[model samples]
Target: MKINIFKNIFENRFSFYRQQGRRQRSRHSQKKERKIGKLKDEIIGLRRRYEKVKKLKRQLQHANLDSPEVKTQRIFQGHKDSSHVRKALQCHFAVLGAVKHKYRGLKNTKSKQSLAQLVSDKLIKKYKCKTYCKKLIGCVSRRKIKRKLA
Candidate 1:
């Protein structure tokens, strides 16, 4: 913390001028200095905010890696809203089994998709998972998607 002796001397001189009833206005450069100081303060504030955000990002990337939540985060990445889809799948399998027994003598397998679709439709309204319901049609026909989902 270096003190400017010239600044103190000029301030004392200004006070003395005020006391002597002789007004002494600051130089025109004072306005420019004030604007520059305000700009410096704003720059410092911006740098501090940027550093704080960067520190938080670094902490999240490196330090939070050992946290249990971080470890388990990827475990549930694909399961965001798939509970209803899984339930509908189970209902489809169950309804399939029941329909197979009821139509043991007939060969009406094309209509089986309708039962699964009905289950998916009803479960979507109940679970409010239309975003996930799109996968219903895929899982109904594609064995690979069902394998991945299950």
Candidate 2:
């Protein structure tokens, strides 16, 4: 009977140690899985960036230098002077505000065009700058009004 009690105690201790080892192994596996997940996410981000670079390179190789799109892109790239951009933005905002106030509650297409033309002419006459095109003014004003409504 004493021998049986000793055996039972030993078995119980052995089982407890085995359970502790299993718990530790599971925790280690979970940590490894988290690390693998992070690495996979990082790899995916790198692949996306690599693909974007490759696509841009392909586009550059196939681009037609004489095309209007290329010409416009070149022109825009060349006109990256901060002062000129700032002046243009200021003019755009001024025209936007004036159109907004003058044509309050007017949503008709004809009215929009008339307001744009009026703003274009006024800016040109006042600022003596031909940068503000009538069509551009019309589109910008329309977009702003649309945003306000939305």
lDDT of 1 by residue, 1-150 (tens): 136888888899989878665332454467778999999999999999999999999887777453333434445566665654455554444444444544564465656655455444543444444434455444444676689999
Q: Cα deviation in Å at residue 109, candidate 1?
A: 49
**lDDT score of residue 25 within candidate 1:** 40
TM per candidate: 0.27, 0.44
- TM-score top scorer: 2
Which ranges of candidate 1 are over 4 A from the true structure?
A: 1-27, 63-150
Colliding residue pairs in candidate 2: none
Off by over 4 Å in 2: 63-150
